[model samples]
Target: MIDCLTGKILKKTPDTVVISCGGIGFAVQVPAATGGSLPAPGREATLYTVMNVTENDVSLYGFATEDQRACFKMLTAVTGVGPKAGLAILSVMTPEKVALAASSGDHKAFTKASGVGPKLAQRITLELKDKVGKGLASGTGFASGADVPAPAGAPAQAVAALVSLGYNTSDAAQAVARIDEDLPVQEIIKIALRSLSRT
Candidate 1:
């Protein structure tokens, strides 16, 4: 039920952060992306958090944004995906990329995460696709371009081109998917970059 915590950072690490709030320190597990964005120790910061409880243990997971925390919740909702696995996936892919990949049925993109095998990746995609698709189609959840269906042929090439430029695979794919598939790769990339830069 703890929605967020805003306090001074007592410690920060790649996988966890200790924040002191109201004279108490709470250790929160976070993905690498969130960890990297955190202020240094002794600096003030805020984290959106989710608390997971089991018969034997209770744990806290944190993210830089509500989008990320929401994604984590969605990820852990899938069968066979634990909070640690969710963290592992988020460590490599941003929440936006994960949502795009899920909605696009790009299972392979998730396989890049540690501990996510092809089978699990496929399950994650299949289950999440519908959920995320509903959210996107309803215009209630993700930001723009999240559920874009990658166009056939040339648009795929444009997505690949953007991936080479250091953009997340699903993100690039969704961006290219929003444009005309007949456009040349350069134009697609240019348009996608412009769209992405605005975010």
Candidate 2:
């Protein structure tokens, strides 16, 4: 229930920080990036937090933003992803990138984090592909583009082509979302590739 914490930083390690609030110091496990984002030991910072309680242990995990916190929760919800693995993913990619990877079927991105193997990475993508954008991202194009849904003929073909070329579906859709839907799939793919390269 520790939704957030605001206080002076008492100590910090690679993936943990101790925050002092009202003279009480709280040890919080955080993504390494979150620990690095904080100021030195005396300055104040705030962490959006989630506390997990189990039969044997209770732990507090903190995130740099509500988006990261939400992303962490979403990632942890996957069948084999524990809090540490969730933190590992966030430590490597931001919430936005996580959404992008999930939607794209780019499971390799998930594997960059320690303890997340090929199977787990693929599982993460499969499980979250349709769900990450619901709460974890906004305007991330996980909705890819709000004005349009995944297209029918040429556009759908373009998306498929992009996916075959190693681009993820969400990214491919976003890249082609604003282009003319009536164009040939090849033309759409070319335009999308051009546009995506600039990003």
Candidate 3:
């Protein structure tokens, strides 16, 4: 039932982070997307969290944003998708990409995540396609070109290319915005690839 945590980050590993609040330290597993954005140790951080209870153990999963936490919840709601699996999915794809994959029935994208099989990907798309649109739309959807400012010089053209390549306007804009203004289109794509690879 723990919905959130606000504390100082005491420690961090690839899969988990320890946060100190009051007099206690709480360890929470996090997806790579959230982990990448975490502040260095000793910095104040806040995470939206979900508590999972089993007969033998209790664990907490944390996200950098409510959108991520909500996506985690939605992923776990599917049959055969547990917390670990859900985290794996989020670790590999952004919430926007995930929503797009589901809504567009792109099982191949889902299958790219570690531990997710083709069948599971298909099932996820089939089961959650309708539900994902609302979540995806909640924050400008996956194609909100406005979220990420366009790069200078041929910015318009780059955005058009991204749109043609299956990315929504928003996703394309964010990806382009992450690149240097002077970088060429190919370099921009490379940078975006590196960023996505980290996820």
Quote the positional error of residue 146 for candidate 1 in Å. Answer: 16
lDDT of 1 by residue, 1-199 (tens): 8989999999999999999999999999999999999999999999999999999988899999877787787788799999999999999987656765786688888899899999999999888776655444433434333332222245555655666677765566567657775678689779999998887
Off by over 4 Å in 3: 134-199
TM-score, predicted candidate 2 vs. hidden true structure:
0.73
> Tens-digit lDDT track for model 2 on 1-199?
8889999999999899999988898899999889888889988899999999999999999988777787788789889999999999999987656765676678998899989999999999888776643322232323434321222356556666777787756788567656787688789889999998998
Q: Which residue pairs come into collision in candidate 1?
A: none
lDDT, candidate 1, at 190: 94
Instruction: State the local distance difference test value for candidate 2.
Output: 0.77
**TM-score of every model versus the real structure:** 0.72, 0.73, 0.69
Query: How should the candidates be ordered by lDDT, best one leading?
Result: 1, 2, 3
**Per-model RMSD to reference:** 8.7, 8.6, 8.2
77: Cα error in model 3, Å: 0.3
User: For model 3, where is the 10-residue window of minimal lDDT?
Assistant: 142-151
Cα deviation at 13, candidate 2, in Å, is: 0.8
Least lDDT summed over 10 consecutive residues: which range in candidate 1? 143-152
